[model samples]
Target chain A: MTTTSTAPLGDITGSEAALRGFLAGLPGVDQVGAEARAAMLASRSVKTSAKSYAVDLAISMIDLTTLEGADTAGKVRALAAKALRPDPSDPGCPSVAAVCVYPDLAGTARAALGNSTGHSRVQVASVATAFPSGRASLETKLRDTAEAVAAGADEIDMVIDRGAFLSGHEGRVLDEIVAVKQACRGPGAGRGGEVHLKVILETGELGTYDNVRRASWLAMLAGADFIKTSTGKVQPAATLPVTLVMLEAVRDFRAATGRQVGVKAAGGIRASKDAVRYLVMVNEVTGGDWLDPRWFRFGASGLLNDLLLQRQKLATGHYSGPDHVTLD
Target chain B: MTADRPGDRLTVRKTFKLYIGGAFPRSESGRSFVVRDAEGRFWANAAQASRKDARDAVVAARTAQPGWAARAPYLRGQVLYRVAEVLEGRKAQFAAEVGRGEGLAAPRAEEVVDAAIDRWVWYAGWADKVGQVLGGANPVAGPYFNLSTPEPTGVVAVVAPQESSLLGLVSVVAPVVATGNTVVVIASERVPLPAVTLAEVLATSDVPGGVVNLLTGRVAEIAPWLASHLDVDALDLTGAGGADSDEPTGQLAGELEAAAAENLKRVRRPPVVPEDWTADPGMDRLRWTLEIKTVWHPVGV
Candidate 1:
């Protein structure tokens, strides 16, 4: 009854040789095929009861992020507040998975989440490893992860050095991911308590689906709890095609190693319709296991209000406007 | 019918495609319905545009609205004038298409084409002047100044008149875009050939991509979406209840209005019967899609 794509890994712990070999021998993705699959999945219709469920699911999966240079403690607090109750008027609205902030603001978000009257289900996720660019050395990167973890980040999102990955420095990317994973597991200063590690490939910077697929495998094999599509920095960040390739990789990786990894498609996904399409893709590609907030996430700030509006529409049976929703 | 003719030359058919973001594409559904000439002969297979197509067109129109709206009023006028010039150049081809599509005689078809081109010219002339006439500074009793200025209401969706074909379609679309608004226009269902040709003229003109995306399909099938789409700010249902429309037409328009209410969209309900497309499409068309914003400022030393 177990149907899967690609060969099974059984109980093998994909070591450097196996990891490298598995990655190197990883079948190249057909560009047109991947794109076509994404497009087809995007067209799946989810309406009425299903739509209500999806809008809530998408809102729940959002990482309510504010990663701007002008980010302040007040801003993080407001964002954390919104994360806990996206629609203040409607108590039925589910809280977001986490409030993502810079390493410095993780403490701010954590404090805000703690002080807020709402149930503190919302986690504080921080972008580490020099974020967007990942240009720093390993020591700086590890310290960055440790800093966010120490500052009360429940999840650590680390961006890979795309420059290295593109130039065939796979070992460097894998080593950094492993070290960052360890940094998240610290009490070693566990103030944050086993911060989940999310490896961001910044797929827009990675040239092709082949590189994206290889990067996905490399991150998962090196122990990424979640394989994220983008840093929300590059131009073509978190495209459906790229996400589709990554989702397929995770699906295959799980079939092989029996170790399930989550997938996060972040950036450029603004509207409820677009988010719904991504959910549909997840449902068909990864099935129900990855549907929860713990696995999937949308890294966006503007996206929350729209989801709130859509959620309100489902509640009131009429479309809601921007005036009705609180702006974070 | 031509099976008996052994040496007949194969007729070359033009594939009618949907114009979205200035690019001609077949419907995402890839399903097309046969559009016949007035004589009931197959004219062409117009793309049976789906909800997805309507959504895509709105996205395009939304994307282009800001840049198009920000253009200098005089520049927008000139660009619209350029569109008229393109249409004028293709007048002969358009006339022939309209003649066959609407079952009109050559002379009447030519007149319709002329009127359509002139309609564009009229709207183009209004682009720079409408704001001046519609907006003004309001004198305040207190030591303050208030100014009311007309702004384009972003993306507007138009269900083009099915009766008049070219002339009616042009009349509805030109005014919407003239006031800085971008539009996703649905062509006349039975007579879409001329509108498709008009789209070709628009694509070649200075109209930015997405400023005037065109979809050729049954309006009833596609309009519910544009009405419900949250991104679309205004809607012109001029083509909704034409002369050939039946009892359900009124209900359809009602449903559209109801859907538009979800977003509190500005809905323009046409007369029960199609308006005579050849008539002067006055300031009302332009006025419907324009938002008047009044700004108040304190008059301090």
Candidate 2:
């Protein structure tokens, strides 16, 4: 079933009243059916060559991340190096799509990764707008996005003001996202590409699948290049059912506006099986359209090693362990 | 469904499944094997765990290792003693399963069941004392205070004894967990009913989930995967050779040991001769499943 609305989304974000009516009118998510469908898709086995392909695809799609308060330049560089060469032993292994880090460390990741951008190049993604907790002023949030963009972040991952959105002041939230998107268009730190803005709803704090759906639409309407699920800091982050609801929103968003936005399921996704399951859901739920790294992404740190290990096991006829892979 | 009921009463058969992550789950492969008694009668159908089940058990054991290891050693002992108490309560059912599965007399089965319960209590006592016995201050030439302590070696994959079943399984498992290591145990393929019952005992006891994941399947089929698994810290091949002479031969044990070398896993090879489970289990298993962590502090004042 498709989740598209008949009304055009060209001017939905022009006013707060129109934005709220559109999100409320778009569609309500079926929690049970969404969860059951996700669980059912999780059980579908993609084995042998299909599994091998999934592993490589998953490896390439990882936003190899490290966002601790104690993150160091050395740690970001090391993570960047791993992203550049995920499997040092096997040169044939694919490099991850990007290296995600805090805004202050974006330059460290960018410097370590060198001047690289676009589809195949390993981009640096930074979480800004007082990430994990978007309880910041609009001026500070804009400055946060601008600094990451100025520091050579190819992509800006901004968190929505969930407090404002939860209290029914979604116009303020939408205005913040649009402002951040504008900030992403500012000076490009010598990198010759548009800084993609990924809007994080932090679905865990949103409280329901209906809210998650509305948030996805709200983000997409406010010019989000990608709609993300979490900030990797909350419980119930990036769950399959929530991602399912978001995927439906993005799919229907494309149908309504003829502009396709990406979906990133970040936080708490660390296993190869779970990553592959997400890929399966993407395949079945949205067809093959969202299978590419440009359209879909996983914001995870430990997930890369597991994908590598699974890749190694497929190559060799034995099960691989964490010892065989680089520690993230 | 049976056609006739003895004494006009129907008996409900128990479903034997693999115990993983503190839950009873059927094998992911959806396969079950008909277990026969010593007299070759249909005993029950036991879940035939596949390689995937073994893999899942390793993941569960890995997840539970840190919390299981972080608990105070004394508290761990109490929890294990609690397991012994629970096992004691289920003694009759275990005795019946062990008797039929091992082809032993009812009295002998009861003895084996009793020995298994005592084994837990024995290891439970060792839990708190093991540190004092194994860890100590080391002599250092430098002006430093050096201390050595034994820590759990992470997830251990144990192949339980095929012939002895109850007592031998307890002998191998209790020691590994007693020292704080979580284990993914491959129960005796021929006789695994007692191991399932033991899993139930562990579930009811204070022993945390994922501490002891039991898989009932071919040891040879599952051992190589566990042996070669990078996440598994140690492997016990006690039942590498077992009840069925056709499976898990001595050569397979050597191959498993070789596979374990990939990650430098601590491997306890199968005994040259059948082991006496009733004999005192030396600190060998405990030591094998533990890593000595030495810390040095500068001597001041």
Error of 2 at B160 (Å): 2.0
DockQ scores of all models, one per candidate? 0.15, 0.60
Give per-residue CA lDDT, model 1, range B66-127, as digits (tens). Answer: 89999999999999999999998998999999999989999999998999899999999999
lDDT of 1 by residue, A75-133 (tens): 88888788888878888888888999999998889889883333346888899999889
Please list the C-alpha lDDT of all candidates, in the order they appear.
0.85, 0.89
Every candidate's CA RMSD: 5.0, 3.5
- Over all chains combined, what TM-score does candidate 1 have? 0.81
Judged by whole-model lDDT over C-alpha atoms, candidate 1 comes out at 0.85
lDDT of 2 by residue, A107-166 (tens): 899899987445578989999998879888889988988999988898999999888999
Spell out the clash pairs found in candidate 1: A9-A256, A187-A190
Runs in model 2 with CA error above 4 Å?
A: A3-36, A117-119, A163-173, A205-214, A326-328, B1-9, B70-75, B128-151, B242-249, B280-286, B290-301
